[model samples]
Target: MRFLVIFLLIAKIYADDHELHSKHHIYKELSHLDLTKEQQHRVKKILKIYRKELKEYKELEEDIEDKRKDIFLQKSFDLEKINSLNQQLDREAHGIENRFLQKMHFVLTPQQRKKFVHYFDDWEVE
Candidate 1:
């Protein structure tokens, strides 16, 4: 059904988000940037804050998976509720990313920031 497709899409998006959000993973990404000691400290601080915020997201993502399974397994369901939850989840996810980027950019110097553009680009999964 159409609802099932939408649910699967939401699940897929969150799964991708979780994969991209690995705490140790970003450290590997920054290893090539040749960061200074201070830069490394700032990055670790930012990552710690981001990880703290992510705890709530993990619970919400789990809830999403559960709701998605419910939709597939249950005969009676409210499509409107599912759509609303999806929108809410999307907003929360984007908000966290936006905040993280802003703080991350604030931490980097202008020169370091120049390299950040390229680093961010290459961070995309193929």
Candidate 2:
């Protein structure tokens, strides 16, 4: 019984780590732009801020999912609660973009901004 419990715990931890890595890989792929050192540093700072927001968003999403599951199991729904949570999630999403843009604007020159836009245009979000 103890061995089984240990194995399950290890598996759960591994799965969590894998999920975190996968998320990081996806974000890296989506944001893969060839940047100079200065550009990279500035973008890294922006991404750092984004990472914190994303972590919170993921927790909120998990909470929302748990609520959804509870509703389904109970054969009841709370539309207002769900909507409120969703609105908060939406605000966080918008805040992520706005904060990133604000940071970028402060860190990048006009020419750099143009280049950054081109890079983003070239990137496929998928």
Candidate 3:
């Protein structure tokens, strides 16, 4: 029983590691970049800022969902409010992504920047 428990624990740990290293696509790409200590620190800082924005986005998502529900359930439908909420969602999404990408590019060196661009096929430095 002891041996079985130990084996299961090790397997679980390995599974978690694989999930983090393999399943997290961005982290896997970042590991390939070979960042220096300062570069890593700067990248972490950039990610921190991104996380804050992401939190806001999550909250905004909840609000949007509630707004959608409230709109649909109302006795009188309001198309204008729905349109306004959609526009706000679009603007926030674009702003968060553009801001994060720019700051991330700024922290990386020229070579790292090239790698980042290459790794993220959709994103260009220009």
Candidate 4:
């Protein structure tokens, strides 16, 4: 019974670690680039900034959702407000994505960029 308990605990730990790695699969793909120490450091900083921006984006999305619900709850529909929110969403999405790509482009070598682009084929903005 003790042996079985320990085995289950170990399996649980492994599963948790696997879930974390899967959530940030970018790190796994970046590992294949074989970055130099300086490149890795720079990339880590870039990712930190990217993550902060993403968090803000997510908050904006949630706020927009709340506003949309409020709009519907009102007796009159606000089509203009709905359109404005959509445009803001589009602008924020494109701006964050383009900036991240540009920063990564500057940090990576041509060969690394080639490989990185392939990994992005399956990548999602969210």
Which scores greater on lDDT, model 2 or model 4? 4
Tell me, by TM-score, which candidate is best.
Answer: 4
lDDT string, candidate 3, 1-126, tens digits: 432343333233334444343234334437667777666656656655655665577689789989989998999999999999988887886787798788877777788777777746332111
- What C-alpha lDDT, on a 0 to 100 scale, does residue 88 get in candidate 1? 75
Worst 10-residue lDDT window for candidate 1 reads: 2-11
Once superposed on the true structure, which residue ranges of model 1 sit more than 4 Å away at CA?
1-28, 71-74, 121-126
Candidates in order have lDDT scores of: 0.62, 0.56, 0.63, 0.68
Best candidate, lDDT? 4
Off by over 4 Å in 4: 1-29, 121-123
Q: Which residue pairs show backbone clashes in model 2?
A: none
Candidate 2: C-alpha lDDT:
0.56
Candidate 3: RMSD over Cα atoms? 10.7
Compared with the true structure, the alpha-carbon lDDT of candidate 4 equals: 0.68
**lDDT per residue, candidate 4, 1-126, as tens digits?**
432343333233334445454334434546778787677667766766666676677789889989989998999999999999988987886787788789989999999988888866332344
Model 3 alpha-carbon miss at residue 124, Å? 13
Candidate 1 yields a Cα-based lDDT of 0.62
Please give the range of 10 consecutive residues that has the lowest summed lDDT in model 4.
2-11
Pull out the clashing pairs in model 1. Answer: none
In model 4, which residue pairs have backbone atoms overlapping below 3 Å?
Answer: none
lDDT of 4 at 105: 94
What count of clashes does model 4 give?
Answer: 0
